[model samples]
Target: MRDSEKILDSWDAYSDEHTDLDGWPHDDHAYGLRASQRDADTVGAFEPLRYGARHLLATAETQLAQLPENTVQSRWVYQLGVLHAALDRLDELHEQWLVTRDALPATANPGTADFDDALAEHHAESWSYLDDWATHGKALREINTAAHKAPSALVNAPVRRTAAQK
Candidate 1:
């Protein structure tokens, strides 16, 4: 089966496993699992956008190369280049942080008395990285918006709303 299929299958199993509430109104263990899965799903949803950004950044590089050198247009391209560079570095750092976070063991076992402690520690580290990753992603979006508007707005100030307004 495909990777997506595998992911779906795992999700199905997880959902089934968490459906039980035991004697309580809500099963705390299962609820926590569901919440963590939701977080993972959110990150998974954005993976495609991140992948697309990488390709677009490469395209920007090629397009920037073909522009006239030492001109206003070239300056815009240079600004985009700098933004892309910083965004790329952020991506790299996020990946490294995620790798380190995921490398931590989830828990010892069902027999271990310290499972809650271990799991809490794992979540603390992983969620912190996840939050940073999300913030970095927002920065990338802001930089991209700035890049999109920079060509017409950076060197040319007092942009007119319309020909009549100018």
Candidate 2:
């Protein structure tokens, strides 16, 4: 299955397990009963991204560890480059949110409508970045698949040690 299908499939299972005992009223006469939308967007988005990224990194690390001595260097370079890019996107957004929150007036902390607006703007932009990441990430995933299949041919020659290196 594709990555997003894997995510939502798992989420559906999780949602079922965490289902609330009580739910909105249902009526046979009414055709328009709508389900309540849980305001768990923060938990919903960030957590899976985190978990998936973690899974990918750990898998890449395991693959790197299993590589032949002469080839280990190259696979790690590809994996680490992608891993760091993903992390960099997340880290920048986290820092942006943290800095914005810190600079906010202490009195307007979280629940107020203005606070919600600010957060909405923050999250909206972050989601846009995520959309772009998903697009680029799909392409990178293909590159990774190729890299994994041909580590020796795929890896660039070793980088020269820097002057600062021990």
Count of clashing residue pairs in every prediction: 0, 0
Model 1 TM-score, all chains together: 0.32
lDDT of 1 by residue, 109-139 (tens): 4346455444444443344334434334333
Give the runs in model 1 whose Cα sits over 4 Å from its true position: 1-27, 50-127, 151-166
> Evaluated with TM-score, which candidate comes out highest?
2
Task: Tell me the lDDT of candidate 1.
Answer: 0.50
Q: Best lDDT goes to which candidate?
A: 2
List clashing residue pairs in candidate 1: none
CA lDDT, candidate 1, residue 87: 48
Per-candidate Cα lDDT values, in order, are 0.50, 0.52
